[model samples]
Target: MSLAQPLAELLEAADRPLEDARAMPPGVYTNPEFLSHEIETIFSKEWICVGRSSRLAKTGDYLTYDLAGQPVVVLRGKDGQLRAFSNVCLHRMSTLVEGCGNKRVLVCPYHAWTYDLDGRLRGAPFMTQTTGFCKENYALPPIRCEEWLGWIYITLDKDRPGVAAALGPLEKLIAPYEMENYVECFRETHVWDTNWKVLAENFMESYHLPVCHAATVGGHSRLEEMECPPGLEAFNYHWITKEASLPMGNAHPDNRRLEGRWRKTTALITLYPSHLITLTPGYFWYLSLHPKGTGQVSIVFGGGLSPEFMADPRAEEYVATLKGLLDEVNAEDRGCTEKVFRGLSADAARAGHLSYLERPIHDFMRYIAERTGGYRRAFAVAAE
Candidate 1:
């Protein structure tokens, strides 16, 4: 119940006006106890995005995720609906599935208790003679799952509001992009040696682009032209209007929904807690984060092309180009975030004032403060 010195400072700093706001204190990232508090207060109750629905295209395709410490599985059922359930077996508590693939029925490797696509217990060998044991009495516990704008989100808190209700304003802001029509090209998971917030903050601001990504995306970012407006209750965002570094970063030749500025602009959005998205005219990529203790983060990284680009005759080349660029950008981000985490543990570490370009980071710090410290902070609507 005792607060670390730096964490206490973080709560104070997060309340400052934007012009006077400083970077969050080191304890925000280094305190193990606070991380546990965050898992319970934020990650457990929020709708955490797993990935795009397109990834589970077939009837039996399923993907597994570790939500905080709990194992979960999201899959496409035989009735053509997406459902989420506890990955642990009803009997003996063994994990039902590992990674992702097509499986007609989920069978526990430990006891061979089989479950149908709908999570009904269909078979259990050697349990037929067990007294008072009925297959109808057992099933995998269902988790709340919903699809919002093509993204699949799951939550352990069944009482939490639906994703669309929480992100309705965001949908209008990005309606022109038709996010649901984006075709997913790839998805991969990785664990990086850094606090989850460090990576989430890194994606929310563009100030580090020119220096951290100098070899790749930084040069094209046009820092002077970037817009860091106030954030909304559900998310924070910034925008940049510049020429696309890769051809696919621009609007596809057939795209007519976007106007002149929208065609060249990119939106960097961080949905409160841990969903970060980079939406462009022709392509999009996102990072979904979950803390793995105080020093590690599990990331669900994925990207794909817009409908226009997917329909292009040279779609394969566009896919290759976009994927290669994103891979390089991710590598650059990894190095920078890992280094920042190391610095936070040093004895001489100190928080510094945030720049105008780092507005999203400041907003993010306030969000953390509000959640973990139970502060009732007001949110200003973000500019489109």
Candidate 2:
């Protein structure tokens, strides 16, 4: 298929500096074919965050993620190692499991085909009648699974470097928060009509805070204090350091070593492909995106308190308040993005100029151009 003209224009814009950059054209958000190309080139090959390994607290604990037309199970085995396997049953391709829980052995509800925690095929009823079929060779196929800072990430492309190697520079910056010990206090899943990139771009900048989040987070958004540092190979980031407006506004006692503004700062990171996070002194939250199609995305929203906040005697009461606050913010974001998606379909809609504050969006545009085959024209511009 020929590249859409509007998309080509957006690609040209992606090469421009922030002062001259344009918001991506509407066609890129509305075109199903472009979305298909993105899925094949980006999502399928990149390392994407699933959730915390802490979610699977014990051997046999498992969770599932559906992406690129496959349901994958990330399971903790008896050996205490986590492995990801295609969740399709071999006999008839039945989905073996749904949601998550402890399973000593995975049994295919369809034909009684069974596999151990490590995904080794242990039984296949009536397999003895098959001419030459062997159980040893029929184990579920494994997807590449790796972890960093207690977060579980998986990639379908075996040769791609692990998330740790790509994100090495971030380790020291993130260690002070001790996110490894932060427990998931709340999580929710929702489907939105907006394209995945729309949400990804929305979270990377604070430009919309004073208007988009006027009722909640906006009052505390100190534009003068914000900064957009250059993104690393693995992610793009923007920093916002100011007091939170909500009840958990008190500065973290654990933030002692964090410099002047760093003590109050929150790093908003968009891990290339689909992981987006906000790390704050008192709490952290993230949205891991999975594109269901050009116009639909599946979002797994999760957040928790910093260890210092969690250890406080008032943690339980604080948890309820925090969740409530985030729910409101999410509702606001969903409404705005969905409206933008709807507007994109209008004939009059066009790309707008970027703000200096939207440097991370510039980084994201460059990131996509560098990785996707559909943007080869844009890649040439970036190379120059």
Candidate 3:
């Protein structure tokens, strides 16, 4: 069988371009209409990494999260099965749960409508005699959900393809990790005043690592030695980096000792729309991007590892180090992206092209265009 055209072109271009051949379009980051379309077409149609699967390890455990402004609840039933439902209460359309917890039944704080762990409507405080108030039909609407590599992924579309099918080549790349064995050690949510696409693109390529994150994460590896395999159409890549040979300037006095501990790191991962996963030597981190508006994005960072790692005293210290490194890198990214957003909004440029160094982002944009049937329209707008 012959390779697809996009895939073939991507592979051929991967080795040739040292810089972006095309400018990244401004609409991807600054246009409200484009942002709305992305939320509806990109986010709702694809599988999104939510939280860690271990968050629902026990029966009755539940967590509430917002996905592109939609409130969702993930729960583990008494039978030890995982399920997801819209967090809106059936009676008054109020949120049934506010946060994560173990509950025998999810009772709406507004009108006291109750639901079982399976999302079946079990009780209502009032309307016992009301006609057409059957509990059978009042169950919370379910969202399609699946667990992969210790992460919980959900899709708003009930009929959309399963996570395994959607991930395609990425699943095979991450298969060796056995991520299900890891336990979550840390999770954090931060709001950024930038478009979600900016965050996705920033994470997809390491071209800026040398310039932007030079102090913390950037100095830890040599960018020149990094190798990106052929094929933009492939879902993932193998990023191999030699460990730090020397100490990074003491950004933190306490972490100065960890300079040359790790010998090498291999991040075998993929960028599926707005989600990103990175496997470090000691642990794994997943970032989920949920766009709030044209200029705002909600980011959730989740970390996973074995229970022993979580319980270790040194692990806490390591987490602190990691968090500090991430804070610096993320702040740098946010500063640049926010500035870019502002510039794009002020200029009103219709489009831009992608650089050769940004093949992953280009591939993603292509995928989105094909899926939404917007490639032709986007190109036409650019031409004008």
Candidate 4:
């Protein structure tokens, strides 16, 4: 039950001698009980990147998304302030909005209950005469929201530490990028037939580049040339590869010039729990993984860069190039993850193991395990 002991055991058990082979057990991906625990411990407690700050740049701008399983609306109020609120209407639990757009106020389709950008209940039709009806106390529940480097992060748990504290040492690590200047360029959603964790683990390491993504990622950045930085800081790691060829259709205008310029790129920085942030040379993208059930997952991808970058003609081309590369990489990953999901579903008792190169998976699993009462508790009941 001691936190340190389980963490130490997980470190010892999951750690591998080979740098390239480290990974979490395959069982973790396929296990239902473990996945449920993650929803409670990891998703609920973590500070997840919900969207970009620019998404709510103007007053009355809002974006509705499913954070974990809870529907949430990220909005900028009339006062030019940003905040997050449970997207569900307090009256009937109906979702306030289905998507993102400019709205002076959020109006529930079920009964026209209205809420301001700051989540204050602005009006409730006919509720004034009802007993126990207090309009003042009927506001949409607020989620803890913070902006860092242009990314908007939300925590479902109100009592949790501030976003900076949850990010720990990572705050200083990404300080050099000045990420806030970027504007959003692309947004897409890809629903996978696999567990969310399976897709995420794919991003945590570079070992699969040679075999899994040879056509797109592998051809551009060779496995031997790819760098994997050390420690948990490395999980949010970024590396610059010189003269890397941009994928077709997504080429930057400066594609020819990238031969020498230091292009920035980053891997999974768990915006706590199921959200992930990745930065490439031209733009930054965020991935939010929402578990639909034990077997299905919804993945939302949002991309952006500074207004200055978007204004630059060359940067426009760069953004295009990055998108092409992402499409290919994601295509390859989706295929593999779907197959893994099918394989695991076909076998209920199978157990999977981790490799040393997958230290990020270990870090992620350990983080989850600590929050969920250790691996023994997670696995024991299910295995029995």
Candidate 5:
């Protein structure tokens, strides 16, 4: 099928320089056909982040997620290794697991077909009498899984590059924060009424923080103090320096890794398709998004404190404070992004010139365009 007109136009806009860029067109968010295209091209091939490795701290701990149309389960096995397997029963094709939990063995609820933690078929009831039924032939298929800087990522495309190699430079850029050492205090999932891209763009820019987040982090954000630099091949980033609205937003008194300005600065990073991270000196949080059709998004929202804060005497209080503040901030973001989606569906919705603060969104649009087969036409705008 040919590319849709609205999405084609959006790709053209995405190629422009920061001074001339515009908001993406509305149809890209509202079109079911376009979402399907994205699922096939981007979600299926990219290294999609499931969550932080800290959540699965023990053997047999597992979490389930649906990528595109495939059911997936990421689990820690008896050998202290993490693995991803298809969460489908080989017998009747029923889903093996639903959510996150500890499972000694994967037991299919449909007919009690059991599988070992390593994806081997351990048992299958009532199949002995059947002719030509060999348990040895069955096993949960393994998916491509890897750990990069404490975060777990999985990909359906076996040939895709490993996360560590793809994000090597990112590790060096964030080395001082020691991201892997941050202890995850909480992880929650929510379904919101907005296109996934809308939510992603909201997190990519702090332009709306002073207004949309007025009741929370608004007062602490200074537009002029924000910095937007050119993005790299794998990711985009921006920096915001200010007196943190929450104490945990700054470095702990015990922190020795960061000095002077680094203590008060926050890095807002977007890792290709949809991993958004806000890393501060004392804490870090992230949102991993998946589309739930044209009008909704599935979000894996999680965060926690740095090693210094985790080792502090008031760690419990700090965790409570950080969780409470993040909850409020998420509520504000949901409200703003949902409103943008609603407006996009209106007849009068038209693309508008972008602010310098929204440079990352422009970069994100270009990434999507490239993945969805619009790259040839999209990059032409850049050359012009």
Candidate 6:
């Protein structure tokens, strides 16, 4: 792929030494042209997380969302399998479903073309006039889908690796948390008036927590306790090993079995393109970011409790408190990221020096550069 001059330069800057590396250039965040390139190369190819298996626990339960520019539907079939398909009908290409709910079949509102929950065509009205057409030959095209640790992910690019293959050893690192059994207790979707990278990078590091989130979660943040070990082949993560400060004190009696730092700290991870998960001993939360365009992002912001947390007698009451704190934390994040988006496009705005704590952002930039075909250089001697 031929690189744009500005994008090429941004990649070059990203490839520099960590101490000298600045935040990515302003154009990387706000340029519509670059965003288009990302949509085609990165969004279209990555196995993006949409939601969790808990979202569709019963047969016929389904959900629909747009990825890149394509509408996708993932549903639980009658056979107890989860599948993904192009949500457009085979007839005139109208959307097959909207929002999310359990149903017997996916019926196209345009002309009554109906499909089974697994995306098999079940009904098509009066189409015998066409030559050599068979109902079996025209099922909705399957979109690549896979579930990893209870999360459902889909990719538009058939050639890309499945989520498990892409994530590789990171799964073992998180295995101690038993994240697969966790529940999707709550979720809120909204459009943030900021670039997807803005929210993703913001969520990746704690550098701004002391300042932007001071009134919220930042009060407990101790920069000295943080660690950003080198990233992996598929992702980057940092340890926010501060003492737990939740009403439940972040430590669960049942979770005491966990060894060392993990028993008391949170693992904040950015799984490539965009799957952000914050894993604490008691709970886990995620930000599934989908870019609406260069200037906007659609976020599925939500969290869940570990089995340990759910087993507590005060579980019900603590849920409400947890949700409220998350809500406030989300607001603080919104304020900071939106303002940063506005700053990125300013004439005087320039990339600034990065703290050692912002190592994940540096890793994230290398991901952007590689995925967008901006550069072929390696990121830190390759993770393996």
TM-score of each: 0.98, 0.93, 0.81, 0.81, 0.96, 0.94
TM-score of 1: 0.98
lDDT value for candidate 4? 0.65
- Candidate 4: regions farther than 4 A off: 1-22, 128-134, 233-242, 247-271, 305-309, 314-318, 348-356, 375-384
| Stretches of candidate 1 exceeding 4 Å from the true structure | 4-6, 380-382
Better of 1 and 6 by lDDT: 1
Local accuracy by lDDT, each model: 0.91, 0.81, 0.66, 0.65, 0.89, 0.84
Q: Clashes in candidate 3: how many? A: 10
Who is ahead in TM-score, 4 or 5?
5
Candidate 6, 1-384: lDDT as tens digits: 233765976877778878888888888877778888889888888889988899999998988889998999999989999999999998889998888889899899999988887677887888788777677877889998899998899999888877888776788777777888877788778899999999999999998988998887787878898989878767999888766658553657777447876677788888988999998878888999999987899998778788877888988877777888889989999999999999887889988889899989988888888878556645454442
lDDT for each residue of candidate 3 in 164-220, tens digit (9 for 90 to 100): 665555655544444566567677788898887777777777777777777766766
Model 3 C-alpha lDDT versus the unseen true structure:
0.66
For candidate 5, lDDT tens digit of each residue in 205-310?
A: 9999889999999999778999887776678888899688888899999899999898998999999889999999999999999999989999999999999889
lDDT of 2 by residue, 1-384 (tens): 345664576668777876798888777777777787778888888987888888888999998888677789999999899999999987899988988789999999999899998788889988788888988888888999998887889888889987888877676557666667777787667899999999999989899888889888988989988888777666778778767775455456654645566677788888887888888777778999999887889998988887777888989987888888889889889988898888887899988888889988887887776665344322221100
Top candidate, metric TM-score: 1
Worst 10 residues of 5 by lDDT: 375-384
RMSD of 5: 2.7
Can you tell me which runs of candidate 6 are displaced by over 4 Å?
A: 1-3, 126-133, 377-384
- Residue 22, model 1: Cα distance from true site in angstroms: 0.3
Going through the candidates in order, what is the number of backbone clashes in each? 0, 0, 10, 22, 0, 0
Worst 10 residues of 6 by lDDT: 375-384
5 or 6, greater by lDDT = 5
